[model samples]
Target: MAAAASLSVMVLLCLAAVASAQLSATFYSRSCPRALATIKSAVTAAVAQEPRMGASLLRLHFHDCFVQASPVPSLSSLILSSPT
Candidate 1:
């Protein structure tokens, strides 16, 4: 049961990554580059903190966080993305 939930989470994260790649260019037109840089750094740090995750998974989460910051991609977009 736990493993099934984990697989579901992975599927959702992959979907978010694809969605983010599509949304990022549209949303960042007026945004400051420095702000984006800060977000990217924070995401990298948060992903690095996960002990059980492999490097590729950590990188994917960081990439996803660049645009899909919220777990569900809405009001909480300021928060970093997390991988299960």
Candidate 2:
């Protein structure tokens, strides 16, 4: 049982490494050319409007990433429900 568990863990770790290797920092650069600049500008404007909003945005982002099962839907809900 112990050996089986160890092998399972090793397999999971190797799979995780392989999955992460496929990710790239510039993955969206070509598909969405201005995505980063757009995000930066929006964030800058939002923070400029109210400095505390930066913290709130970060917290929402964290929740979206870690707490939500589906990030896209959670993020969409957040955006739609947010006060404009």
Candidate 3:
């Protein structure tokens, strides 16, 4: 039983690794050639405006991951909102 449990854990880890490996740096290269550079510039500008915003962005990522089904949708909503 112990060996079976160990094997199960190993299998799950391997599957998770494979899943992550499927995400590539060039995943959007063809679709959006400047995506990485644009995101980097935006992040730099944001952090320049507010140093703590970098950590806040990370916290938002965690919050979206835990509280929402997906980060993109929640982030998109936030991005698209207009200030009152």
Give the clash count for each candidate. 0, 0, 0
lDDT of each: 0.61, 0.74, 0.73
**Candidate 3, clashing residue pairs?**
none
Clashing pairs in 2: none
lDDT of 2 at 78: 45
List ranges where model 3 is wrong by over 4 Å: 1-21, 70-84
Put down candidate 1 lDDT per residue, 1-84, tens digits, no spaces: 556655766777787778744456647647665777787777678668874455666677687766567545442332234333
Q: List the candidates ranked by lDDT, beginning with the highest.
A: 2, 3, 1
lDDT of 3 by residue, 1-84 (tens): 556555655676676668755678789999999999999999999999999999999988888767775423343444355243
Per-model C-alpha RMSD:
13.9, 12.8, 14.2
Error of 3 at 14 (Å): 16
Error of 2 at 53 (Å): 1.3
Q: Residue 38 CA error for candidate 1 (Å)?
A: 1.3
| Candidate number with greatest TM-score | 2
lDDT of 2: 0.74
Q: What's the TM-score of every candidate structure?
A: 0.27, 0.54, 0.53
Runs with alpha carbons beyond 4 Å of true place in candidate 2: 1-21, 70-84
